[model samples]
Target: MTTPNVSTPRLKAPAEVASLELNPHDLSATLYNNDLAPTTRKGRTWSSYSIFTLWANDVHSLGNYAFAIGLFALGLGGWQILLALGFGAILLFALLNFSGFMGEKTGVPFPVMSRIAFGIRGAQIPALIRGAVAVAWFGIQTYLASVVLVVMVLAVAPGAAAINSNNFLGLSTLGWICFVSLWAIQLVIVSYGMEMIRKYEAFAGPVILFTMGALALWMFIQAGGSIAWSTGEAKTGADMWLSILGGGALWVSIYATFVLNFCDFTRNAISKKSVVRGNFFGIPLNMLLFGVIVVMMTGAQFKIDGTIITSPSDVVESIPNVFLLLAASTALLVLTIAVNLMANFVAPIYALTNLFPKHLNFRRAGIISGTIGLLILPWNLYNSPAVITYFLGGLGAILGPLFGIIMADYWIMRRAKVNIPDLYRTSPTGTYFFTRGVNFRAVIALAVSAVAALVLAFSPAFAHLSSFAWFIGSGLGAVIYLAIAKHGQEYKDVSGEEIAVAPTH
Candidate 1:
């Protein structure tokens, strides 16, 4: 009996083992986890640089340039435009820093982090809303990127102009060809996944910076040295300040939607320090430099053409040398496509999958979302100014409240302690489970703020306050949620793995 003595192996519970098993149905959730984990401490520094490159790609694009100059076209002078750009960029910087901090502290993506505020299941509401908006923008940006491809084709084979003669739904045959081709190109790039995107940005960021600088210099030379303000009529200082504030607020609001979700990418950072530093270099410095270049180029083009040119393509076309014009156009095309891919394409792919973790995996969800975006193309729904304004404004309204609620809940209410494991569990005992998977305080805060923002958006009486909708909504939501949740009830005790919130410095 003594000789037959044996040792027993420890048996692990099936439920414990099951948690570690990879579920193909939840590929998006898996990717989200992979994206959030800091695999190496050294890689943390790259996060900031990656985010900085992201903003560089975002700010230096043709559309952003056009938007900057469009402010001047609103009867504001060059100085006023500069003021607006400065103010708007600063506001965006601040908001992005706050949002990025959450990612850095928790090592979680935006949709997952949102579960803390909106609840585990309720997070789907914001995810779907964001995904829908992203899909629409993705289609529009793809269309814009195709413009360059079409131009290159026409330049090489002049016969291609004949394709433009036959039209369907306001688009020529050549335009449709370019659009589909570019769309397919983006799809292929996205399919390669996020690592490819990082490499693409590393190259695209510097290339765009160089080409834009060269184009600005060429424009200045063509204008014969100096350029003056192109304001058609002079205005009082008071009027100029008013215009600047209005324009700046509008720009900030337009940017606010994306800025709130900055964590989506930054969560991959290996360290929080890198993210803050990267945002510092990226937002204010990069944007200010890009804004200056845009203003200078627009001024130079104004002097030469005797009419203000808002679009970067218009500036490219103004160059007398055909070769230089072609070069600039090609660069703008590359820059546009890079930004469109980063900002629009990747976000929705992940977001949509988050909505149906048990049904659509990442690739399948991306396909579904992409297909829906294509279906929306024939209507040209994205082109309508009224619709675009409403879409952006409505998103801003919801996002503002969401941001506020998350900040208040994390920093003010919980004192920044998040139970990481509980985020994945649907048990009533989870930290995020509030009233059967919905936080009523957050819901009410969002609803109230949204109604106020919508009123500001649609009612002429509140038109004067419309530009500040983002700020108003966020501020109100944070205050209201804090007031409600502060005295109401404390969250239930969950698993005791306490993660410290990074201190606000």
Candidate 2:
């Protein structure tokens, strides 16, 4: 069993980086060897534009419009909310850069990458948790997008709403058909593979942007063509600051699922430089501009309707032009599917596939996520804004520590290095093969920190802190992991051979 030189050069033109030969000895079972394998030595040649559009695909959705408008509930004005959003984006950019650099360096999905910090098998703990969240959101996002289709049908023929209005489990029959159809469309995209998903989003993102701009403009004009911007006045000094930060947290939580597994996307990037550049364009800058349009339209909605309209469906319903309504709704449906395909669908497929790679190749795993998605009753989740916010907050709370622990394990503890072969090994002697391929310290760190954070999230006594769950949980997880990891799980090794014995068992 052997690998070509481990000291491969990086940060070169994609043309210069040769593809890597599979390391014969380090290969794991076919399950581990599924799409999660660290064998993609020369990743797809994604330029800065691809990464930039990645954020566009990631963010350009109905949810982005809603989440941005939701921040107004915190009573922060447009400029203040924008400031908080930018701050969160800058910090997020740095975090993604750190993780994405690792992906570009390692050429593995997030689950496989976690093996460096979480033990080889233990990595499933975080992987499954992330996958579960993605699946729920995948279904929820599908349902949300389908709502637009329903709206379009109703607008085309106002009587169409009653055709399938027989409500079952909170969703009408028409709603179910639309939701299921959107789900199937996403499955088709996943069936085509990741590159196809990228190509689809590349086209969809720009078109969505134009459609959104037109909608926002129309809404503004309908709202009297004047900016009587409210200061979004706060009741108290503490409330104002809280509003901004809370808005920031919601901003973080908006795409929190992706933060835990961004490596999956970055791993496919052409180079580290490209990933960083792409994130800059995609995340912060893109969100900044997108949020501005959403805020402007939201404020216009408040003035005209006497209440803030966060949902795009509500905004489209206000438009009298049948042609415009149909066009906007159709554009939104396409954009939502594209975003769901990129953000919600792919990560979980890879994450769940990692759990039992032998049985669940990417396609099969995607089918499982899709099938399970049907059972989650995502329509109920979407209808309950308070419930869904907490659900997202809970996800942020758990993921924060997990993210902190992994980053700590990668950067602080191991100094951005790992014995690649040991990652797939089952031998107790292997560095990542601790205690039957599970690192107790990492597990304990995640459990303790996440539990404490989430307890606060659900606690009415401390419910206010839920907005900062990501920040607090991340800090606590990092600190706890840092303190415990002082025992320092083995990384440097004797012999300096940079290879592990191929496991036979």
Candidate 3:
């Protein structure tokens, strides 16, 4: 096992490094770059318990709660929705487990690991794609998180919601403050590094899970015998079956963004077993619990308020008791911070940092990524289904294909044997160097799959297929990539075992 040399000194910025290292004749071009190399061969530092809560933290966010609400609203019964969610969660588990194995086996992040299938140069295709998705979600989540903060303000002042008459840039003065405040808080938390993040998650994950359960119980009591077992959707026959399948597809698609970048987290897990065990329990079992909470809570809201309310902030606002609202909002704030920093923010920060390692490490790249979130005007985008559908759906259309291609290249073609150092080499003789560092083959596979999926996503005639965008795109890309690549090329590792290495030049 090899490790990336994190200590290697880099130039101050890309400009200085470009001049010094970009020269075609320079030895620097082929030499492994410190930031992009395979590092941290040791596995299993993070226990299964840590891994479990890590994902639990992801589930506990308001965005997820809201997403579950929308899925439930798709006319599936509560039990039907759970069953659908279970199917989706199982698939998610299988997908993340593969990514986790790669990460645990190699100890590199998603972008670096993807270089195997995409070529070190071509790998940027998936890197930027996944990173862009992460950043978009980051913005959406930041805006979502700030709702709690804004609610906190309203809970305290009670009259501040009236100040919305004088709003700016689509957000009221108070809204702007909360958004920026959460944004800054995220930066501060992210600036502290992954250890700090895990620590915060350790504390916050269980709190939010417990809080959600308590809220569900409280609301159920308030509804007072009105809590119905029905999900308000079809429960039997063909309509119910279609609703279940359709809702399942949408449910899986929701987490497709995380599926691609999961290596960023898995690389830190203590071992392959830990990763597998964690995801199995974390995503499916824990997700089931949260689903119940969301369904119950949403049902309670409907009974009491005459409408389904999924947003925690909205529920807190309606509490009427300022003290309870204040406590609830503050608790939600902590959970949202955990979700943004750990799940949404960190991946893009690394993906972008990988793009220009000399100029940006995690901290610097993070600021730039966070700024992009602000520019996207997430306050407007967060609440809209069309925007969510386009951004997340579009990303899945491309990234799903990339994920398929990478897995096929690694697992099927290369037989899990990586010629580790060759992944970083720029020598013409190097394997991954294809036509000026880009694998046109991988690019082609991705383009075809993405274009087809996007057509479905954006077009009304085929829009129904958009719901299954992830499954279709990934399976299509895999088949196409396999058809295009050379076969029967047996590779071997240093110890003389027959192996499947990354697709090379």
Sequence-dependent TM-score of model 1? 0.87
Give model 1 RMSD, 1 decimal: 5.8
TM-score result, candidate 3: 0.86
Tens-digit lDDT string for candidate 2 (15-82): 43432234445456732654775535443656688788778866767767777777777666777778
Indicate the TM-score of model 2.
Answer: 0.87
Stretch of 10 with least lDDT, candidate 3:
496-505
> What are the TM-scores, per candidate, against the unseen true structure?
0.87, 0.87, 0.86
Model 3, CA-based lDDT = 0.74
Model 1, span 462-487: residue lDDT tens: 87787777788878889988888745
Pairs that collide in candidate 2 are 31-357, 31-358
Alpha-carbon runs more than 4 Å astray in model 1: 1-45, 168-170, 359-361, 391-393, 486-505
What does the lDDT come to for candidate 1?
0.71
Model 2: residues >4 Å from true position, as ranges? 1-23, 39-43, 157-162, 168-170, 223-225, 231-238, 381-396, 486-505
